[model samples]
Target: MKKETIKAGQITIDFLLEAADTNGAAAMFEFTVPAGAKTPLPHYHEHYDETIYGLSGVLTFTVDGKITDINPGETCFIPRGVVHGFDNLKQNDAKGLTIITPALLGPVFFREVADIVNQPGTPDLKKLGMVMAKHGLVPVVPKR
Candidate 1:
């Protein structure tokens, strides 16, 4: 019944509502990724599917080993267990909305990442990986 706004990483996250907390699902969100900002390294969830709709500017998404450019009105679906990550590649910030199905632990994941980003000192990649693992997330290693 209430909305929340969080400034994390290079994005200002506006959470609309908790769609299904008991089921770990959330509704739409206004995600603003600042220019030149990149999301966390490619990662995947074993039980969640993420769909992204770009609202403004351009978003570069790297899924598996291929890269795709998404602009306003564009959409991309990332199936469960697929490695995916994105970044704002334009001079202006990119705005988008992402929906995760079966929610899984996505909300928890976002909060954790926000905490790490706000912590002092450079983020420790290894520790972050551990934190992600606790929520069934696995980082995708680039192909050789």
Candidate 2:
């Protein structure tokens, strides 16, 4: 099957190995984060662990209130239920490979999110939250 690419805002995700390819064991994808783009909402997965391997540039990740910059050739493991978010604050785009266990999330989730995110004007937070919740990603609201 042909791989699918989903674009949500300034980020592009190419689905490399989906749940079908992995028999539900895992799903792998490559993502690109453009420089200067707004960071994704901090969120946590309640059902699957995620591992990210940096490919180029740097992906600055905030996990459970701790910030870390994952540079090329480095990796970060995010256990389930750990609130995490990332951004490409460098001058160049950051690329990476991500693998999630149990393959619970696939193109459908991203597609749904992309639809909401790519819409004209500001996206509806309530709808986005609903989609994320349906996919087991719980958004984290920052404390003032």
Task: Pick the lDDT winner.
Answer: 2
lDDT of 2 by residue, 27-102 (tens): 9999999998876689999999999999999999998889999999999999999999998989999999999998
- Among these predictions, the greatest TM-score belongs to 2
Off by over 4 Å in 2: none
Q: How accurate is candidate 2 locally (lDDT)?
A: 0.92
> Would you list the C-alpha lDDT of every candidate in the order shown?
0.77, 0.92
Give every collision pair in model 2: none
For candidate 2, what is the total of clashing residue pairs? Answer: 0
Cα TM-score per model: 0.85, 0.97
Count of backbone collisions in candidate 1: 0
TM-score of candidate 2 to 2 decimals? 0.97
lDDT of 1 by residue, 14-115 (tens): 775454653555455668888998577788888778788989988899887689888999999989888898888779988888876765654555677788
